[model samples]
Target chain A: MTILSFNNIEKHDGHTIVFPSFQLSIESGEIVGLMTSINVRTVLLEMLRRKIPVPDQAIAIDGKSIQQLGKSYHQRVGILSIDDGLYERLTVKESLLFYHRLFDSKLPIDGILQLTQLEAKRNVRISKLTFSEKRRVHYAQLLLSDPDIYILEEADQNVDLETKRVLMKVVQELQKNNKAVFVLTSNMDSALAVTNTIYRLDEHGLHKLDVMQQEMEPEDEAVEEEPIVQPVRFEKIPTKVNEKIILFDPPEIDYIESSEGSSQLYIKGDMYQSMFTLNELEQRLLPYGFYRCHRSYIVNLQKVREVITWTRNSYSLVLHDQSSIPLSKTKMAELKEMLGLK
Target chain B: MTFSLKRTLAIFQKDYKDVSKNMYVSFTVIVPLLMAFLYGMQGDMGVDMVYTVINMSLSLVGAYIQCSLIAEEKEKNTLRGLMLSPASTLEILAGKSLLTFVTTILVIVFSAMIIDYQPENIVIVGVAIALSTLFYIGLGTILGLVTKSVMEASVVIMPFFFLFTFGSYATLLAERFPVLKAAEYMPNTQLIELAKEVQTGAGFGDIWSYLAVICVWIAAVFILSYVTFKKRMMD
Candidate 1:
């Protein structure tokens, strides 16, 4: 499957054309690297901005015109800018939540928090954090959004060798999951590390180079330890699009069946309240916090830090981070009774 | 929830953070507050203090803030990060201008409240501050686009700050010397309009005229700055 295809893509900036004509595409489950001089970074960024669909000619994706699928293209396409695009005021978690809202779905954020190894620093402001730490948060954000086509600009610029390998492993994992990766690298070595197909964007235009198949031949890595297996292939399995939306599975509430025959808990944030269905959630969370706080919602008593009285007839729940969730009139008394707050 | 809003908020929050930590933050918040007090104390200070501080608060401070923001980001190589997002130049400018406009209004309110100086038409005063700040922020953004460092932002902005202080000569001359009528468009013009509106309860017609002038300036400068920024992005 062709996840991304750019044909005869030209970009102009009033006076002069930045990219004259470019043609490129990445196969499904392939990680292609784009190597170019540092001078081209600004122009390339402009190309993405203007989305100059044709280099004065033509550009398309999966045979559909780029002009037709413009913003739609962006839905599955994520661009990692030259600077990591970290909001300094946002703690790592807030940053993730902010981007999560854009995906039109609430994500299981804790996994990404842990995957990026920023859990310990989750609460710290990004501005006060170190460069590498900030970059980690940046990468984590890109991952959590989970785009099928990720355009990474200079992915290996500031990290250590160990971290670079970890990032490469991540790209491999993404590729294994059938995501097409477009990497712009100034370092040919870094570009060669993760890519089978490589291209160069230069004065002429974008040139698709032959795959560096010499060293990457599959048979060369035959180790006695185990067969170096290729990634699993589902022939004609269809792209992630036209496929069912996969809800991100996060850790579910783990609770023992209470001897008292009911489990009540507190889970805070408008985030959870919106994601869980009151009735269906009631069945799944019977052993947990699925206590009917009101007709509109349920609460996990364990997650609540305090109950805040909003007004004479209204109240809000204050959770761990001081984030509030509204309680319906009926839910409040039930919640209060459950907590013996009356 | 669309990409643009997410991107816009990201830009907004990021710029907000950058400004909050700026050493100049104290100057922006404190200078207006302090000078507003000084303007109220006509015993030791004269109307000149009122003119200079109030003028600078509404006009120069926002420009300085915008200039400093661009310079700081350029120094950190962070502007390139924002340019690469899938947002149009208008969206970026909208977010930035909104931040600049809101912060500028804060300075205006602070100065107005502390000095016991009220505008003839509060709405016109609002329109004036918004237009003037928008104009100046656009101006400051152009300065930021042209410069290399945050400190350089001060150099470009200081002359205007000084003008609003000494530019009163031009205003005094405009009062008596018809030859100085040519200089009315200088920094003194905005201050004179504001002073007239504040003291004499002038009609909103003048404020509207001034706002139109400021709007034109903002539009011209914004287009120029955007072109410059875009050219830089293509570099």
Candidate 2:
């Protein structure tokens, strides 16, 4: 059952458009993740929290319009934002009991403490707890609310491995109770680790991410020498900004450099991290006027304005942005042959 | 909007625990009682001296404490958590204000007792004190909503604190400076005036104007606070 949904929603700040129209639907007993930037997350969370009022039919809870449901809609949907904001002076049990009464939740306090694995810390003040332990108190508040749909914003961010495990376990527990969970995060790895139903939202639109392909990457590399699978060509190179995957067209990239065994794509002075190694990126970008000018660099031939030979052993390729990339002495010969310049 | 005593009391109880543990805010409740005791040592307490202590309580225990509590919520971003909870706006505001309200009244009663100051008309003075507490709470709410942190709230509340706590004394200079005459209309000044009238055995009908002036301040401050609270809710 679809517990919460919003469709064709548009948001703007003054004359600028924040996010274009998009639709999202979360079904019961499922966990979904949306990957986007912090700016987009702020806009999206506001829309989901119903702070930014949409048109009459834009948002719905339990298949009814949110405006019609009014404040009662909040009871069905609870948002666990990055800021847990627990009272620092209160004990864990005291804080949980307060929310339990506020939301009129029937869940026992001990049950919540056990679920979040804070039973030992129940008597500890929030000010005295660890960062992750405080986050567990946040999860406990969510359980105390016991809403049918839980909207989590970066629930796994900046926590220890144990807290991450506890968060995942809590989501699984919610799914067991047939509750819907929606996670909004900028970290692609966090999204993939939490659930398979992940989507990436950007200025373009919302696109479903293929988690199967992502998980199969390591296996694909392991089986590469066997040649059992055919080579697949991709025109768009995927790079990441703040853990969000952004697919960039080959023409938009100025150069690619390998740093610490990972590929970095440069475009107009801004660096974006790519998951592909330098060799893989070189192979994929070769047809798009790109050449491996150095062991650590691949320069786009179209953007190369000048090739400076400082010495017989030292060479550089200068692009239109006035940024120079190193050119290997051997690859200098290859570039000369490709450019038909002796 | 739904009203739940269970939820309100839960918030009240939570705030009670929170305030008791926060020495920065909880210790402020003792200021007025201490002031009253010092005045009692000097001999019979005048109505102005008694009101001086009561007005200090209104600004300190009422406005300053309420402002710190709400600002602390915003500072820690806990206000958003409460706003998103199933509890209604009324429940949260009433629940929070109830603590400050009770504290303000208790301090006022203690200050009155410490100074051996008795009102000829307890009903009239009680009503005035209650209205004045509401006014201070409303003022505190507005300050809390405008400032993002408790530090900012303390800074922003300085002028108002002086004006509300000592604004009544501005009337002492009203004859020297014609512009200072407006201070006579301030709620704290009206509170002082109301207490004086009641001491002279004035009935509700005899002192209705002073009560009405304080009521006007309450209505204006509450309206602004409610609007500010609504705006902050969206933020």
Candidate 3:
């Protein structure tokens, strides 16, 4: 059994901090969901791939520092991103065989082919395979390596319902095999469905959510002794503006503007000072069609009118109110998916 | 394990299979042999032509093959999978280099056979060609790391190929222009000079300095390529 721990880990890109002193631990037979913004996810994956130096006692696997493990550390960790990094010319069998040989793995090829249900497409070139088939091939390749830790980024994106089921089944199998799985995804429903534990990664650090308690709060609180029915609770976020506190319904807020470590809520032509940090507000409002489109702005998806591509790398979200909000280039695809554009 | 020769051989075989399917890479391997055949037909199979053929084989074909193989990986984004694998950087480098090295030697040997060029000392000529091949492969790797696509790699490698191979001809103009003599110190020039010494029956002791110069060039290029590759991989 392997255990991976992050003890007060801090990561930064130059002066801008990405992960700020977060502590997390995952052991075998558990699936952990890490929900992070698109930009932070990109930077985090890059750091993990490069094996950037970590502070002493910050990160450890199996009770040993990752830095001290050297190349052997990768042997225990497997990563699967949206780009599976497959060679189009290579057939499914040949691709798996190549990785198997490169890793000097003892796992049998037939077992992997069977596990991924790719036995019928063994001889088919990756280019000829469907996107789901290619994804399965990537899972098969990862199975050949048989790592103790699996990190999957955006595993559910652009996949059909059936493919998502197959992926979830694979995740279950990995858990049964005593593998620790960490999934980073923007799809909250899928994450909530498969993962036993959920954590939100914001500017402050990693915050674990009590999934069961949050889900049961409504029903449990409504069980009063009286026969009278309780009114449905509409969640309201309180904000302070000019020494006065205003209760604003979350759905009514068009966007939140963050500057100088403070935030302001824009609700129907009115601005109010926000008591919470942008990170905290993002977590509280993400389920309500709000997306952290940029570092300083979180726009409600219902209010977004059009997406404007100013350049190849620059993008802006035109809201219904004719106000433009900056969108991260890396988050464009996800935003499109969220908007059902493609 | 940091590296394994068996794993490296496995990667080499995979590369061979991949290259066979790529028409452009296959054509690159054939170009040098075609040049050698043309030189043989024209009766220009002298020591100078032999050096030029060897230079073309190493710098032109070698650079294209190595650069394309790597750039294609980056284009396909499979290098990241390899990097994330248990295989060490040394194993990947050695594995990829093995195919380039073997194919290069085969092209050079076939070219030499077609030209009917005979060296007084076969060992010295082989060493010189091997060292030159290593140096060119290192340079090719650097080009591959910096290029974003196979087309970019081809465009970037062309000017360097000409400057290293055809640029040696500048030594012939050294008497008229003193600054042109500096071309003699180029890696390809040193390789040609070493090959000429072998043709004139020079022993190991007589050509030690030339060998040293080529070795230094090999060391410098290899170090630079490795550094660049590591940095690019991180980025």
Best by lDDT: 2
Give one digit per residue, the lDDT tens place, for model 1 in A275-302. 3334655665555454555454455556
Interface RMSD in angstroms for candidate 3: 1.5
What DockQ would candidate 1 receive versus the native complex? 0.10
After TM-score superposition, what is the CA distance of residue A340 in candidate 1 from its true location, in Å? 99
lDDT of 2: 0.86
lDDT of 2 by residue, A48-164 (tens): 777777798788887788878877777898899996588999999999989989999888999889989999998899999999899889999988898899999999889999999
Q: After superposing candidate 3 on the true structure, give the runs of residues whose Cα lies further than 4 Å from its correct spot.
A: A10-20, A50-52, A209-342, B229-234
Greater DockQ among 1 and 2 belongs to: 2
Looking at chain B only, the TM-scores across the models are: 0.83, 0.96, 0.96
Can you write out model 1's per-residue Cα lDDT over B1-235, one digit (the tens) per residue?
1436665666576567657766565466678778678667764444456556767775467777777777766777655544433455566666676677778788878776777765556766666656667777877788878888877877877887776556766757776888877666654465456656655677665556655665666788779988888887654
Question: Which stretches in model 2 have alpha-carbon errors above 4 Å?
Answer: A10-21, A53-56, A62-68, A213-291, A296-342, B230-235
DockQ of 2: 0.79
Model 1 misplaced regions, further than 4 Å: A6-24, A33-59, A64-76, A81-91, A94-109, A125-131, A184-342, B1-10, B42-48, B119-124, B174-179, B187-191, B205-235
Tell me the tens digit of each residue's lDDT in model 3 across A1-342.
Answer: 547887887777788878788888898998999878887787667656655666776777887877777788778888888875787887888888898888788999998787778899999888899888888888888878888998888887876776777788889999898899988875555566577487878666776654442232356545665587649743678775333344666777889999888998986455768889999899989889899999899999899888899999999988877888899987998888876889
TM-score of chain A of 3: 0.64
lDDT for residue B123 in candidate 2, whole number 0-100: 88
